[model samples]
Target: MRLKILLIAISLAAAVPASAQTSRFSPALLDRPDVKRALQSVDERATAIVDEWIHLVEIPAPSKKEQARAAYIRAEMQKLGLTDIRVDDMSNVSGVRKGSGGGPAVVFAAHMDTVFPEGTPIKVSREGDILRAPGVGDDTSNLMAVLEMFRALNRANIQTNGDLIFLASVQEELGLLGAKHWLETSGYKPDMFIAVDVGADDVWYGALRITQFKFFYTSPGAHTMESRGGPSPAKAVARGINALYNIPLPPIADGLGSFKLPVVNVGMLGGGTVFNAVPREAWFTVDLRSLDTPTQDRLTAAVTAAARNAANEEGVGFRVETQMGIDYTKAQPKQQRLDHPLVQTALAVANHFRKPGTPLIAPADVGSTDANIAVSMGIPAVAIGAVRERLPHRLEENADASSIVPGIKALISLAVALTTR
Candidate 1:
């Protein structure tokens, strides 16, 4: 019976109309001679783009301190002959290239901040096709891709029906703060937002819901011998970490539906001085993630409660501060459908460049990105990566020089496709 059912399903699938399959390329758009020239220009300029990537990555744009790098990118945008250029109070740099004024306003954004701290020597070293440096691959590659796309559009003089807004957002690594603030306060809300991040392997439609908490445990300090019977903040923090990690995680799947469970992790933990002395304070950070708002809240509450309980048992003061996160309750049109036009167009671009017989773009995975703010606000948003990288957020971070051409090509294609849609 099972075999019979499977055979019937296969027959039904085979009988589906060809029109149901999304086209990987738009004939009219691809046939344009100007588009061909534009793409070629991107290919020709790919080497220069990588050079810009190295230069920008070495500028050091840590979380809240992105002024210098932001200024650099703003100047670069000016060099592209883009109009209406400006940087916001939060340090998000943006500019506009006016189109025919008939289509949607498309925003192409790349985060300008890195996870590294300020003053971390960002000197980049090249070894063959690999460029190694802090903040090199994680986002600098994508930022350069944005710049190259702008240059191609201007060079090709490819006019679209809508405005193409180029954006370099700040504080993205600090938990989407820049994006969230810009979306909420900026007078202009884009009809479509594309966050250029990560690599060329896949496009992400849904943004992950994330909650970060800094757990602080306070107690009286004393020498180890005299610290007996007094609550130890370090012990309380350790207990909280153990309990939080022990929280059962749901099976990880790339499904388009509501989430029932979450994956919890303790990212940073530290709290103690010398061995002989008991530290008066200690704190650790927790990263809680899920697609379901209720689940995220429940898990966050559980973790916070655990920390409090530990503190109480140890006779120490405990507190949990929301360091960075998305308020699930505030998001609008929460889940974007898998078949949204923007998403399909992105897949089309992916399929256009994807190796033959390789799978199309992967299913939308949960991630915390700048697009999260746009997606939460019911705006059609997607995030894509521009280069290949081995290690991200590490001192040894590196990107493949070979990935630059296709990466920028994909961005240019997707932007043109969406703008003309």
Candidate 2:
């Protein structure tokens, strides 16, 4: 009779569509005694959180060179009494807050690397609510917020049924390499993944199809006097760039604020020893993105063809190298991903704690985050932000210093709600 009952329960669960299983998150969870204490702790330590944010931003954490920041995060993880702390070869730091069992494991990830190079100035400047610095808002603010979230949980002795893993990833700006490595190599497999790397007002549930390429044009050398008549890699580069831009793009996808989709951009260009000679080689990088695979493939072909055509027309040799390539064959279906409880639960929790008077938050079907790695692996994941950051990857990047208090509280609530459920 027990065996029959177990079979019946399994059959019943399988009968329900994934979309019907809604998120278990509730605003009422915030009122629980332990949760209330955690929120209060954030309020009490708001000043220190901002101060640490400033200090962390100042640390030079350029991609593939995040040792300093990784050490700091590992030390903080130890201070929080988190177990199984590990700093991987790629400088990805992870620690586990063990739970009481009977719930899903959730990973909260924030990248540590910034786009700025090592020598870039990152001294944070504060003006009332705004804090400006090179790496201040991008992932640094979110990294600090996640740390505080862990601290607040410990402060209240909040325990859930499932484990919570905090991951401070590196090389995110170089194409989510650290996350991809950790998820593939780490022995643990999480039931849900949350990348805390966007602005507080934004929630992204879909992974954008992104492909980056570096196209090189090469030609035999020529002196300044003979350069005009000889094949020039520089001229081929100029032509290739102009032709790539001429490729007709599909209409931009809607609901992505200020981000035009199905777009191609030349982000980097250079290659010459001196200006007087016809360069032997010139190269430029193309960052192409689209909302879906078909569009991305079509554009990728067009971009490469345009580059090759330029090389042929200019009588210059050409080659292409892929800088970042994502394989989406293992990704979940669109509706299945959108309907998953992880995304819905995050939406509910984020909206509940969102700043008043802001527009209702909606999950955008777009992402260029470490969560993209999880999405491609068919894991349930969503990307959300901890603060209202702006101008990411620019020298003037800034975020609202006052917004972090609520942000930490929101993270606390989300972690408790998801893991306890």
Candidate 3:
């Protein structure tokens, strides 16, 4: 009976037309007078938009320290005349553009935090169409773009059937904390969620399983001469890291660009306070990711066991703490999520505005953005980019200065498309 059910499901999936799934978004929507005016507004304010983007990028918004950016976004939200504007305790800023009612409520989110520290220089440099800075492209560019998209909607007095909520999420770089807090506690429950936090050419419809662990090894401190044959936390840390890497990883999933999946990386390590002594404690962090839950669970168990085993072998005390563990129990099935209008509409609208001669935008099944929180909650969500950016989370990060013009226009169209339908 289970085989029969599986066969029937496969046949039903095969019978559905691709066009039927993406029919909610039509290019004709872009031809409407209001949308046309909104698109034109982006072109007219192109220079100002880029300037604002650069200025926002220059503001340091390290994770959990986004007050400056939050203030700016809140003020801008007020300027847009949005209703129910709020700055949550976690620094997440959100406002609503109320629609005529009876249509789905949508939330468009873009993170305001970057991976760089507070003292890092964030001044943006421009050489023709390229803009370079520490946080230029990752989500600063998208934050600027989403702000402009809202401004353009107001410029044309465009109204839709459903309300649009603009969310400037904080601490997204710290494992989507701000978004998770807001989504869980906020009184509003949106029907669809869109995270404008990737490149304009890509769309992500699924959330990857991500777990972060910080393991510590402890022992009594000792002088260098006395440390001989004694259990050393530093040595235990080394052995544990080695064992973690030696643990077998599942085969890498395909189609994720430049990312090797089912992988474990030891991202940070620190130990001794002095060179002449064995430290009392040493610790390392592990970031593990996979495309599926079973693989993620298996690897997570292996990682913990390896750390404990190393501590045992080295005769040191060991304890592990989870830094980030996202629950996916309420997540929708794969086929149901893929067939949702939220994902299909985003794909259609994104590809419609993609640069000419570029390959068609395809939706990937991986996500590392704030949308992951929404996906885990069974909310219809998709993550799409707002600019062509490179070298994210690096000092050399940069984006095309001119790509944002069309990117904003695309955002305008997406907002209108999703809300009106």
Per-candidate Cα RMSD to the true structure, in Å, reads 4.5, 4.6, 3.1
Candidate 3 lDDT, 1-421, residue by residue in tens: 9999999999998898664656478999988999999999999999999999999998889999999999999999999999999999899999999999978999999999999998998989999999999989989999999999999999999989999999999999999999999999889899999999999988898998999999999988899999899999999999999999999987778888778998899999998799899999999999999987889999999999999999999999999999778889999988788878888888888889899999887778989999999999999888998899999998999999999998998889888888885
Per-candidate TM-score against the hidden true structure? 0.90, 0.95, 0.96
| Angstrom error at residue 395, model 2 | 0.3
Clashing pairs in 3: 198-385, 199-385
Stretches of model 2 off by over 4 angstroms after superposition = 1-21
Candidate 1 error regions (>4 Å): 1-28, 254-261, 330-336, 355-359
Candidate 2 local lDDT, 1-421, one digit each (tens): 9999999999999898443477667777888999999999899988989999999999999999999999999999999999999999888999999999999999999999999988998899999999999989889999999999999999999999999999999999999999999999998899989999999988899899999999999988789998767788998999999999899999888999888998999999999899788889999999999988889999999999999999999999999998778888899988888888888888887888799999889888999999999999989999999899899999988999999999888888889888895
lDDT over C-alpha atoms for residue 199 of model 1: 66
* Candidate 2 lDDT score relative to the true structure: 0.92
Per-model CA lDDT versus the true structure = 0.79, 0.92, 0.92
